[model samples]
Target: MPIAFDTTGWQQHDRATWFNPGNGDQVTLSYFDLVPDLPASLDDLPKLRHDLAVVVGEVGCLIEAHVVRLGDVPALLQVVKVPLPNQPSGQVFLGSFTVPKADSSAVLKLQAAERGMTGMREAVLVAQLGFENWVMPHPYAPEVQGRLPFHAGDDPRFDPQFADHPLSRLRAWAHHVVRTARVDPRFAALPPFRPATQPPAAQPPAAQAPAAQAPAPQAAADTGAADTSADVTGPTSPADFTAPPTPTPPADFTPPGESPAAPEPEPAAPEPSNPAAPPGPAVGSTLTTVVPGLPIGGYLPLWVGEQCTFWRMSDPEAVLDKLGLGALARTPLTDRRFRDLVALDASSATITLLDRYRAEDGSTGGSVVRLTRVSGQEAHQALTTDTLLDAFRRLGRISLAAAERGEHVTLEPGTHNGDLAEPYVLLAVEEHEGRPVATARTAPPPPPDTPMWQGTAAVTAPATRESVEAGGLLAMYAMNTWGEHPLRLCLTFGPR
Candidate 1:
């Protein structure tokens, strides 16, 4: 007998989902952990480990019986497994339950029994990860009549519901969807909806237009003026407010292509913003100077057309808790409204958040973010390492997730964790002495000769900055790390 979640015993099955991309089948168990009912203490550690192995093994459920040290600590362990499937096999991928930080099958099943939806978190779009996406404790809903679970919806890209439906209509209604003919019966239909946390279904695409949209559409719009004629009872039309006058098309409306006179000459663009802007070097300012091998700050006014940036603050909440500056953090970001580039900076030592404003100004004044900078007189402080590492992890998880899905990636300083697509195929914060130590980063790897994919940088949100005299060295460290990658192939310092 074999453990239920353990892939070792199942007959290897070829899958159409896993073979589509050039990158062939490979198993990856993102999460495998025990949910101890007993206290995890040093005195009871050995007994806990043995009991886990015995009970799990008796049911053919243990992946491997092993214990790992947490630096000098002894209670924690990172188990090992002989591959069978990357994820536990089941009817449909119930993304909600099968992910990192969550407990193993026994734990999930217990929790699911207690809660109708499994109450599992961290579910993601494993589109590129394959049928491993479907691995679970049982083949989908264990109580269902069919073996597989049913999600409710069609692939919007291949279907028109996501596009043709009005924003108001889509949000108010649900998609009509059914299971694949081969799908198991117990599973009900799947919903075409994404996690409630993702950008709303009707979100307009980035680059849809420059920021500052003509305000969002309003409900109960103003109706056109009524006729006030024999059958009418409402106010007269605004057009009728004045006489029903018909203005001439133009003083000189000409027939098609009759050689209309040319318009007068147009004015030239204004001179460059900074007259003394750096010269000789092709890059902008020392801060704005972006060498192919340099960090983002090497360039100024981070652009949207090509270049990008990311940054963050120390503990943004600490400031709010101490000084009551929560309102400052809540202020919305505007400059990067077009959603092209992400800006990370600290308003003060206390609070930090990402600002999604326009990259370029569509009207007078700077980008919307400039107006919405996160600052309060009471919250003066610098950015910190948490902010920088957060930015890095965000880029790794999400920016790459898009790359994995062949979708676009957004690199912003303030984006949340678990929001990324999957640029970072693997990222873990190395722990020591039962505590998180340093972070480890790994990617699918770019081909040799083009190290462009590898970027390591340290950004000091304004909170990270102590003074102009110090000159945001923490940020410089991140930029330099990102720009300066070893020419050597295959990682020398990854996954440790």
Candidate 2:
């Protein structure tokens, strides 16, 4: 609505008003009239990339980002990739340019899904570059793991050879459009967006200095409020862990293959305290503030039903959502089969229970449903068996052969690992209408080397709607190891 460009050589679709090239590639032009804090200039692209990183962290990786111009107007361009679910070799690529003014912005996007192996070009390119293998280490910081490295077709190093690749095509088109595009006069005349700056807090008189001031800095450090730079590992302390924020286009979009300049480092934060207490959001309270961190699971709102209840934010809900309760919200929890059905592995008399809703209904939109163990003494009492808790418990045990295969196996509550460290259980809930409702709880940090997205490491803090809206929730993804594809699920919450 805010910009115009040629639509040559393209068709149209219901949702894609721009154009399609007959192939799977699509181009769309749209605008958000009011996107708070969207910068009007490209100077902020470096800072904005960190914010954009949070959104793209889940399900994809940013291949290239740049600050450029469109018809004399500053703009941002970006290229990203999202791996297709259940298709290890398939990928969805997006190339876009974002132009922002004041509190609004316009976006021009080109998207294409490639179903073939993504790195074929890399094999040849690697040999030409004198590399032994094409699988190079990712260029991001060490904390940013699990994301696949830049594929050859998307990687700029091979752009000369892969000129017909989606990313390359998009770049050529973006440059042409930027040179000829026209913006609505009214939109261009709007006041430019300015970043908000916080004033220093007023200090109390020396005669009345607060006695507890010493702990304030420690608290800030523990919550990871001291550093917003990229180098800070996600969730330095448990208090900072949160659900992944919803993905959104940032104010600036750059060309594929161009990396944003790293921002100046912030002062180092003080070391966080290693508290043995569990880490999670405060549930059932009206408190709006929570520490921001990576998303370990999906977000769910509190629910209250005649037969069941739910807490505002909890990792357990995310766990259940991944196991299929999320899609079955319309189904009555009172169903007996959902409450008590169990499968026995006769080979070892082991027990297993699949997410019957997913099994019987074939819904959930391809979300990976793996049996997540709800360990700890409190898990049993917090979750009611009549509400499908037991069914989820045995689902993990159905794969005892995984342990024999040397895969990491889910352990039951009260069980110890080879190192004898008890798995900390982070769960809590309340009961209403005689139905059990679980809430969030705290737990000690997982082992330093416990990779994210693996078993228990995937369970961090619960996210709430308010947290996401306030920019306290970061969208971070870990691989979903329990499935053939690397898929992650986002839990949602709402009142029924």
Candidate 3:
């Protein structure tokens, strides 16, 4: 077989001899599967047309990927990159032996898409535009899925500049992946794997939303929810509340040595006023794409912070194969990004994003503000449950733009009191400190009818009054902004 290591730095490629480079030529069902593309619905697409331009908008490759085994246990040798027809380039990525033997390719694709979803917002929803042209769904299909503008085939050359293009972002994403693999003991000890295995059973796919063969009819209850799909506020949006009388609690509520001296004081260390409430369990959810026309991936990992945001990507099938669905899909609420931002907050420099703005310059000249810690009582009200994603997404967008622009930042750039008006949901605010903590999660699953997927955002905690109020609006805007790719797929700088 044409041999080489894939992105994950593991043995990869089909076991078939056609995978061999020694053979002059070979043909097999290996090529039967068409490169994937976005589908509105199977019934909606009576014929397969390979028009990435029609499928997605602007396309930029993934820049980097940080892969970790989804579960505690691991197996199999998985490859994570595209193989050219020539020499091999062993890229380090993550995959599991446990992935069902059946149609592993589709699972691998899903797993790769998931990896993209974890660290960066753009990692999910792959764009079809400016992509290369490959063969159609079934080379002889009545309609073709068409080809990407160019083939990444071996010996093919692209402008060196494209190496840095988002279209080719993973060129380096694999670098760290290999570094990670060398240390991953499971990788070092895998038994020689035969990529060829028994095809998967007829079990329903985890990433594919609906049962295969036929669509499950929606229940009448589903119809009611469908009408209110735009409510956006979630289940808690409707509730009853009344103002409560407030009074000073006992002196025990005060810290030692800080309580007011009383002629006859009730002396005691301040007791905890309130303990944190348990966050709700995973709830039924609905997700949408940030970039319109982008093909949905298998998994979504959300990262949120005071000013940083990321979504780490992994292949769901690989994760499932190695870790099982429950393991990789833990979909942890607090990801590394959130924890790092929390750590950064300890020494964070407050930047007034509103500073240096001139009304003439189209920005309000804002004031100075400090970053403050959120109190237990204030966490919910400040970071409100529904809107956490807005803040994180806005930050994620700005962070990327900042890197692209190579802009250095010091203190919070906002005027001492100026606010950063971004397109996101605000979660928490320390007005005294001028710090806002926002949280958001994402779920990018395959389509309900087909094995296609995208994303859903979940938030924890609350923001200041303003942040909470704007959460709904932010969610709506997010849906619209990323709803579609604005252009044709695969716009090559030159010719195809």
Candidate 4:
């Protein structure tokens, strides 16, 4: 009788989900191990090898395997496939080996020799052997369904009503697994699960005009009784032309003392107080208050618009732990808002939170925050060369080098004039172990060169931190084959 092979146990151990073959009373394989010695009665080595290979294939690490004769001994050869550079139609060998029948442990002992191999090999082997029984899948795994009761409002898993549900116990198990699992180095090299794109620049709200001030009271000017002394001048005919003698003041009229009655000094008008600062929303918008234990009092600002201020947590990990924002950190900034707060541009404003004003209950004491735009110099001063270099390094997915010293590649020109649209250049070149394997470039292409001409190209200064922070490089490329081929390309280095 042939031995029946079942991989349900392996699947459950490695993936944490039992495979339902929809059969009743099927005996499931509980464990698989590379026995040190082959059974003397086991005559069909080829059949056993084939069965094991099939199991491995189900987990997607299958490359190729076959039994071959090594001298007088039977040996099994296995090849594990890996990603290659540059050519989508190509693949390079990541791991390849032969396991002799006399040495059953040889395959299990294999280790990767290169940077990319370490992670790839470990991932593959783990899938084949499965983790320990205690190991569980990621907490957020969608496959683990119905952990919570359907009708339990407010997540009854935490309440006494659903204390016995499987979900109630999942949290502690997840924490243990997450804390104890061996971290894969390849994860560090991987790009962010979702990258952030430049958000649309925010338009400033229109400013409101100041309220109208009451008009000041004016004093009446004193004029001597409207020239009563002057003779009423009617239309005087030339015949009546008699020059009126100048009226002399009465001899008895003494000059009034106090210099002819000095005009009463008009009460000095009160100067208006400096206009109150214009009322409007302050500059940088706060996303959420920093979790307790953080040094900063303000909230993390969203990455909105061109300028905004965000709290720089001294201990980000601690804050993230308290707020459960680790998963959110992996997502694109534009996809989620922190505490439902929108981001304000840092360049335009500063945000400060009044944490000391918390209410008696410890909730926010009604927002005592200030957001105000900064001066132009203050807004732009932070984007120094070092700042940009740090940002580029933090991106991890891309790299920047001096254009003059960087490697260049020539591509066949396409059929559109580069002038009409922005010149398209390779934004990034994916590499594996420092070797270029793929290329990602801007869309649209320039017109193809004439039969006799190649293409024109040029490169600007290397991308600075300022440029990248400003959203994208402003470099241009033009291709001409006539005299000298000018290949203007912006090279971005990325992971393979």
Candidate 5:
């Protein structure tokens, strides 16, 4: 007998991977099972009802798993009218799992078991009900059902060839039913469903109007109030506020037993000196070249302030590299008239190389090398007075020893000139009384049109043995190159 249930609200609830026996690929089935809370009367009817829904699709992806009532009637009204035996709701499992493509029977059995159906009979009933009244029912022709091979014994089994048989194909087809239903307008207007897992929205407290306040009581007037103006007089004139005059002391009056203080002594006049010249280098100050033969040619003082020392170097690459500028030496010199400016910020030991270009207007432009702190410190320490002097002395000894060998002392090209030079001249200024007086050699002006090296010259005569015996040793140096090159390397030490 055909089931008497209505198919109105019966939604398709087939697993996404339902198998097609004919092609051996998973297929989409279309049919809805009765929802859990649907009228129990329809549960046993063996047919879809107008109001029934099922949790369809994969378990995690289940959709439309809601409890709906028949027609527009309230659930309570339907329950009161319909006689449905109270029975535990039947489970209608929905979802697909992996299966061998070659076997059609196994696929069907697995699908049925997943749907909570028992035995072959229950599975067959579900397939039939899902196919009935579907808009696009599987196995369109009724004759296809007869072609499917079915085992006759109580135990449902099929031959290996059964997959190719018409009955097997129809069974697979029956499981795939596509049905479309009109969505009720009322459902669209309903509020969206919020899952129970989420906490309820907090409601804002209602705004309350402020209570009206009563007017304050009025103060009673006093019958007799005093008039404060009667006690106050008119403002006084400025002349009436004069202070008493200070008393004057007699000419000969002095404090008892204290003799008159002696008049302050006048300050002595300073002794006269030559006004034509500026006060010469603090009398006892001495100027000495710490590292002589410091080739200053092709170099310009870019900056020389208390905290900053900058020099533009135009020396050969080999020379600059030796002077703690190996990195700058490696960089290609693109400009025709470019010089590397070595800048030292006293606070930081890093020596920054600024590639300066001499423009046609004699102005300069350049970029500074970005050096790390460690590299800067290393470079700065390499150029310290102590380090350079040590290297200078060692090189000088080597040159003198070679000369003593009776061989021509040909200094190596690109070698520092100070390496083969004489010992640097050290000068000491004699101290007059407690103050030390400074003495410096003034280089005579170079011949006209000649580029004169403007720097302090060393004293021609070394200090006498008596001067050496003097307490103060004003300066020390490793070598001197006063008149050798067309440049003078002058080092001014002391408080300056």
Candidate 6:
């Protein structure tokens, strides 16, 4: 059935696909023609549920299932949770509605996977089960030698605890989907569904010798297709779980792919320390000679603001350790203290710290710092010509008036300007002979209390010798945040 729902607060990734802004939760709609092995009759909801459990295997557990209706058409609603095979500590909660017809079916699915609550739920189960360690078979799955008896008190399916849990959120979204669903008149006109005595069999190997082998059925995630495969019985390994490949954009669009390495550092240049004073330009260095990009010689980009500073590091764990928050590296993303100390930004290689320290007034305040890491190639391209132009094309483009005037200019989202609400860049240009040369520096970050939704206030400051140099180019764009982190549309890259 052609279905539509309230997609409020969801960012559309592509056709029939959307993702939650910050949490990495995803939802999609898809159609199927004769799910390979399902009972033909849509009325056999129990069989459908059983088949779902079997198809998901031991790696996943069915939290709930119900025979529901999409408009007037009957459908099966299922909630399943599966741990990601790749991540050390994370689980994906899947909620799906399958509407089956005589010859076709449609599915609307939602996937939510987060760090903090997954760990907490697992810990609660482990503590109650008395498991020797965290890595153990699911408590509710087919019993393993070391698996403990399932208890209703702590079981996520039975317990009404952790209301804000990802699974709980998925269930709520499912209800929203069902309530808001609309059916297509053409689909509803199709013949009613009827069950066959037995499910269809696959073609014999000898019968299809000349043809390519049928690929194994995969998890219906990215494409939103129905998963059709034989029941996985007995024990199943973690590797059996299939996850879709998700693209992660880089923090700066300078390209993370192979490029030339940075040139050797000067003999007197010092290695940039984690929390140390950010390295400065060499003595007698000028904006014309010293341009900012990614730091060379093992140094990182550092932006010191009035309320906070932005730092770039090669390794987040090592830098966090020096900040005395080594434990944060192991903490869940949902922990209260962890969330309090850290704010979500782009890139796992980066860290946004709100340090708890006493100010001169003896009042407790959090000193905010935004840290990001860059590859040698990304840094190299930021200072080069050809690749830099290519990377800038992917972002919202803009042109600064620095070539004609060295004064500050207000920038807003529009044609010839970035898509961000405010311009966070400072440009300085001077005429050399008949040609114009320029330097671009980042403005200080907004105050810690400034609401990001409202956008950071315009920052005006002199260009630093470390800012990127624009010999003749006067273009700029809002830099992209990388990794699975939500897009901030912050950070400005100029001279491309």
Candidate 4 displacement at residue 413 in angstroms? 25
Which sequence of candidate numbers ranks them by TM-score, best first? 2, 6, 4, 1, 3, 5
* Model 2 C-alpha lDDT versus the unseen true structure: 0.37
Badly placed stretches (over 4 Å) of model 2 are 14-16, 36-41, 116-119, 126-143, 151-153, 198-496
Error of 1 at 114 (Å): 25
Model 5 lDDT tens row, 1-496: 0001112122212311223343332322111111112222312222111222111111111111112332221111110001011211112212221111110100111121111211223223322322111111111121211111111211114423344332343333332311111112222222222223334344335323225322211111111122212111111221221111111211112111112233445579889975452122233444221121232322322223211222333233333333321122111112221112344432332234433335698755432222223232333434544434333332333222322332111111111222322323223343356543322222232222221112334222112221221101111221222243212232211111
List the global CA lDDT of all models: 0.21, 0.37, 0.22, 0.25, 0.23, 0.39
Write down the worst ten-residue block by lDDT for model 2.
466-475
TM-score list, all predictions: 0.18, 0.39, 0.17, 0.23, 0.14, 0.37
lDDT of 1 by residue, 267-355 (tens): 89888786442122122312221101011111112222243322222332322121111111112123222122222222321111222
Task: Judging by lDDT against the true structure, name the best candidate.
Answer: 6
Q: What tens digits encode model 3's per-residue C-alpha lDDT throughout 1-496?
A: 0011122222223231112233211111111122112221111222212222222111211111222331222212222222121211111111222211111111111112211112122111111111112111222132322211112221113324334332233334333323332211222222211222223234332332123222211111112224322211112111111111112221111110111223454489898878543222223432221110100122122112222222212232222122211111111112211111011112331212132225785755432222333332332343322233333333333322222332211111111112222322222222224533233222222123210012334332223222222222233334344332111100000000
Q: Indicate whether candidate 2 or candidate 5 has the larger lDDT.
A: 2
Instruction: Tell me how candidate 4 scores on lDDT.
Output: 0.25
**Model 4 CA deviation exceeding 4 Å by range:** 1-53, 58-60, 81-109, 113-304, 308-442, 445-496
What RMSD, rounded to one decimal, does every model reach? 29.2, 24.3, 28.6, 43.5, 46.8, 23.4
- Residue 393, candidate 2: C-alpha displacement in angstroms: 32
> Candidate 6: minimum summed lDDT over ten consecutive residues — where?
249-258
Per-residue lDDT for 253 in model 5?
Answer: 20
* Model 3 lDDT, full chain set: 0.22
Q: Write the per-residue lDDT of candidate 2 for residues 1-496, one digit (tens) a residue.
A: 4445555566544322434555557665554544434322356565566545544545466676677765445667877776555542345677777766555566667776653334334323432432213233334422343344433335565565777666666667777766666544445445544545523334333232224321111111112233312211122222232222112222123322222333445579999897443322233323221111111223221111221111112234333433322222222222211111222222231222234355455653322112223322323244332222133222222122222222222221211112212332222223446643222211333433323212233232112111111111001111112221101111222222
Instruction: Give residue 39's error in model 2 in angstroms.
Output: 9.0
Residue range 270-294, candidate 6, lDDT tens digits: 7767585323333443311111112
The count of backbone overlaps in candidate 1 is 59
Q: Considering every candidate listed, which one attains the maximal TM-score?
A: 2
Which sections of candidate 5 miss by over 4 Å? 1-357, 361-370, 374-387, 390-496
Decoy 6 TM-score against native = 0.37
Q: After superposition, how far is residue 327 of candidate 5 from its true place, in Å?
A: 18
